[model samples]
Target: MHEIISGLLEMTGFSIVGWETILMWMIAFILLYLGTFKEYEPLLLVPIGFGVLLANLPGAGLGIVANELVMNPDGTYMTLIDIANNYGILNFLYYALIKTGFLPPIIFMGVGALTDFGPMLRNLRLAFFGGAAQIGIFSVLLGAVLVGFTLPEAASLGIIGGADGPTAIYTTIKLAPHLLGPIAIAAYSYMALVPVIIPFVAKLLVTKDEFKIHMRKMDREYPPKHEIKHMRVVKIAFPIVLGLVVAVLVPSSAPLLGMLLFGNLIKEIGPNTARLADAASGPIMNTATIFLGLTVGATMTGEVFLNLQTIGIIVGGFLAFCLSVAGGILGVKLFNKFTKKKINPLVGATGLSAVPMASRVANELALKYDKSNHILQYCMSSNVSGVIGSAVAAGVLISFLG
Candidate 1:
């Protein structure tokens, strides 16, 4: 019996108690509790929490397991550290997704395909609102510095203000790779909470007068749904032209630009029967999202997440988002001075990180003020404009910092 128990224990990997394992397990449970009960970024948190569990498992080849071994041609193993480290998907994922900056652009492509630019075309002036909202990014950079973060670290933390997750992640990977996980989680978590966050800030910035302000109907008209059915040729031209211009101007933005253009092409041309376009915005996107969230969460193992710096990143990101809200609303209020037809300042809040959610919130707020109000069209323009603005800001940061 004793011998049999010993064999089972060996397979179990550990028979000893240690503080490190205990700490890691506790952190995992906390993540689970928050995701399950509090419903805080659950889609990501749940996957991430599971990843953490896998990472912390005894004898797993995660961070804690490090032994050098080489497999011979016949499959026999050699104990060695000198041979090349081969077949590490984690390393590949890190390099391809995090280091080379690939995933964000692919995500953006899907975003662009699903996005409708008509709203923005109708409200061209709203581009300034998007620009103003990005000012918070620089402000948070300053705040991070004041709080004792290094220049590079501060820059990474500041990107959260752009309200763009991929931008934030890309900047952090280039500037402060160690902080990538925390900064990314903070950025996305806050984005999901935009509906809750922007309201108080919106109400505070603009009075009922501004929130309830009415505007003239857009003079611009979108083409009938099938009016451009034969414009498939134009789709190809659009991507070719926009991709060339953006790629030539900002090589760093090529990824996002390429993705956006590809998505648009897919939408314009019906030839994408492979359903790649649909999948890009559907299950594929969801799967990638789950992987991204959990992988990011997994990086928050006890040793890294338990540090004071993690707290700093979270606080810095929050401030960045808040400042962005203020900047966007202020920009709209300033614009109101010149235009004869005024936009509800509430729509400006949609300039924050959550793309459609921000726009939806603005419309909802507008409806609350007046039942007959239909502000979504205008709010959507500002929302898409925010995406561009965020991407532009991110490109600038990458060019200057990276």
Candidate 2:
């Protein structure tokens, strides 16, 4: 029996070892456990875990392509070339979607469709709060550099504070494509876990008395009789203005800001093209998301993720997020001193790129203090502001990094 087992192992050529491959499988398991049990961004983490699983299986034809340098058994270079060409599906997927950088904006179109900009317009001043909140992104960027990440790698790592997955993916792929898996996983995992993460940071920034402070009623200054119609001129003009003002002024920001404005225009004026909107918001977006997550996870492949640098990114990311919460609360408190109107520090937490989730949490916390509290408006103002602030910060980073 021992001889037979040894013979079988030899026949299968099982002597070669791959520690990296084994480590990647462990990563897959951890991701799956977190997504399934802890419920940490299951939509993203679960898919990412499966991708990691797919990439690590040796001889499974998962992450391989035949070498073009080798001759075939038939003594034909063409045959070997044909086989190699046919086998690079995952590689093809990675380069086509990730390297070409088409997926993130497609995902953003879906986000824009799902988003309502009304709250942002309702309290335009709150946008400043959102902008202040993203101080974490720059802080995180500097922190990542201090931790010994290469500039491009640090740029990729720092973008996590945006609380925006698409932006994170776009920036990371451009700056350090190899780090995509850990960065994507971290970005989406934190986004999904925002409900758990932001509240703790928020609570620390304000006293219980401050947390309990009631916000003033939202003043709808636009005349009640005058409905804010989606004007065709404004719809047409806004994207063009954004493209020129932000894109031309900060050329490196063109990819993200241009596409974001493009998607918004589609939402605004493409009312006649509901199909285009649906496509952008539905299968087109979802397909891109799956591919984006899978390809990013594949990049992890054990060896890349085991580095000391990855640990530093995660640690710095969390600190950046915490400090961002502080900035938002501090900004709000400063504004309140001049305006003499209360601003809930909880709303500041949403200032990081986590968007509606942070806003919803803030609103819920307000209601906890007072059932009659209608702080959703205020929370949303900060939430949307976070979105724009993150985008602008992305532009600024691209300028320096480019």
Best by lDDT: 2
Per-residue lDDT for 1-402 in model 1, tens only? 999999988888586435776777776787678788988667766776676676666665443111123346677543323232452444334444545566666677667667666566546666567778888888988888888998888888888988787677767767777787778878877886787778878878888778777654423232223344434565457567877887888877676767877776776666554387787777766766666655565566556666899889888888889898888899889888987667678667777646788888878888888876778887777777777777777777778877
Q: Give the root-mean-square deviation of each candidate in angstroms.
A: 5.6, 4.8
Shift of residue 17 alpha carbon in model 1, Å: 5.8
Provide the TM-score for each candidate, comma-separated: 0.82, 0.86
Worst 10 residues of 2 by lDDT: 217-226
Task: Name the candidate that leads on TM-score.
Answer: 2
- Candidate 1: residue pairs that collide: 48-294, 109-259
- lDDT score, candidate 1, position 86: 56
- By summed lDDT, which 10 consecutive residues of candidate 1 come out lowest? 62-71
lDDT of 2 by residue, 306-389 (tens): 887778877877776677777888888777678645677777767886767888878887777777776887788788768767
